[model samples]
Target: MSDEYQTSGEYLHLLSEPAWQALRTPVALALRDAASDATLLDVGAGTGLGTEVLAAAVPDGDVVAVEPSPALRAVLLSRLAARPDLRRRVTVVAGDALGVDLPARLGAVLAMNMIGHLDPDGRRAFLRRVAERLAPGAPLVLNLQPPTEPTPVPFSVFGTVPVGHHTYEGGGSAEPSGPDAVTWRMRYRVLDADGTALREDHADYRWHVIPADALLTELTEAGLTGEVGPLDVVRAVRRT
Candidate 1:
């Protein structure tokens, strides 16, 4: 699988409002303690939804929104450009967080709904980088989804929303691709007022499942302590 959000990113933005509604509170709570003037990092910031949240969370801080997908970056940039306030506070960048050149010390890190993109080795490298660059007591917040081991996920409608004169639907299914990974098949559809399909797009991506224990152990090995919170969210803090 290409695993990049080439085509999917186009439609994913349409459903972001609902996702943001669910994410807003938890994400804010996670970053509530971050210093107001500290620099914040947002990894895999697709379409800038989480980036917007981060900007709101730290009004006085600079936010670095890192996205590796060009399609997603296009939308992210557009979003920033439209809001001069966010445009001033956010610096959009390309590539993985581990490879990007960031500040010597970070105030907080947000990696929402993107950790599965990294394999075990990549995860280790990312955590190590976070450990090295994150300011002492700064938090790295991310989530771990289900099927920690490779397993099949049933096809289900993830979202269905009605716009002006059309309805947009999106859903996905996943199949075991390896011992610790799954290949997700996503389907998106646009239906006219009469309920006829006007367009459809299909995409596939890979996700490497990480068990809670495995991730906590990795955090500890990287000199960070982590706590698993509600909704499978993990908040790890760099050691002093």
Candidate 2:
């Protein structure tokens, strides 16, 4: 499973206002204090929603926003360019979350919206590698919907949303591919206010499901003390 944000990046960054607003605050809340005073690895940092929060929290520290998708990285870089101050705190890079080399050991790891993209082995390996890169007792945050909930599907466009010059109509369906995998089909169309179509994209991807406790066990075996946080975020601390 590729952690590529290519298909959804532009939409999410530009006109997916409702979704972004819903995600930004909570994600930041989950990640804000996790990396205070230390360099952070915002793994799978799609367009930097979570990265922005983490960067702001650690004012003097640094963040290496490791993104695997060129489309997503472009949006993130543009934002960083617009805010010169963020360059001092956040450095966006294109690399695989599991395989990227780091400039420094991380005080925290933020993996959001991409865990389900990995297979079982990749999930376990990712936690292990995160443990290897973290400072002792640093946190590893995995943000997503709880695995126990039934997947959402056939979702209608949630009230047409307008963001800046673009209006978006988007929704999709998620079907269980198997006990561990779910296939999502999303279609989004961007239009100008005058009703001219700007661009449309369709994305179909598969994601695997691993229960929160199962993931915690994997982290524990990798030498981290782990638990599901109050908001369904997985929080683990590396063992010294």
Q: Can you list the residue pairs that collide in candidate 2?
A: none
Clash-forming residue pairs, model 1: none
Candidate 1 ranges beyond 4 A from true positions? 1-3
| Clash totals in order | 0, 0
- Compared with the true structure, the alpha-carbon lDDT of candidate 1 equals 0.86
lDDT (10s digit) by residue, model 2, range 60-140: 677889988888888888888888888767887778766788746777788877888788888888887888777766778
Identify the candidate with maximal lDDT: 1
**Residue 9, candidate 2: C-alpha displacement in angstroms:** 2.5
TM-score of each: 0.95, 0.84
Q: Worst 10-residue stretch by lDDT in candidate 1? A: 1-10
Query: How much does candidate 2 score in TM-score?
Result: 0.84
Model 1, range 167-199, lDDT digits (tens) per residue?
999999999999899999999999999989999
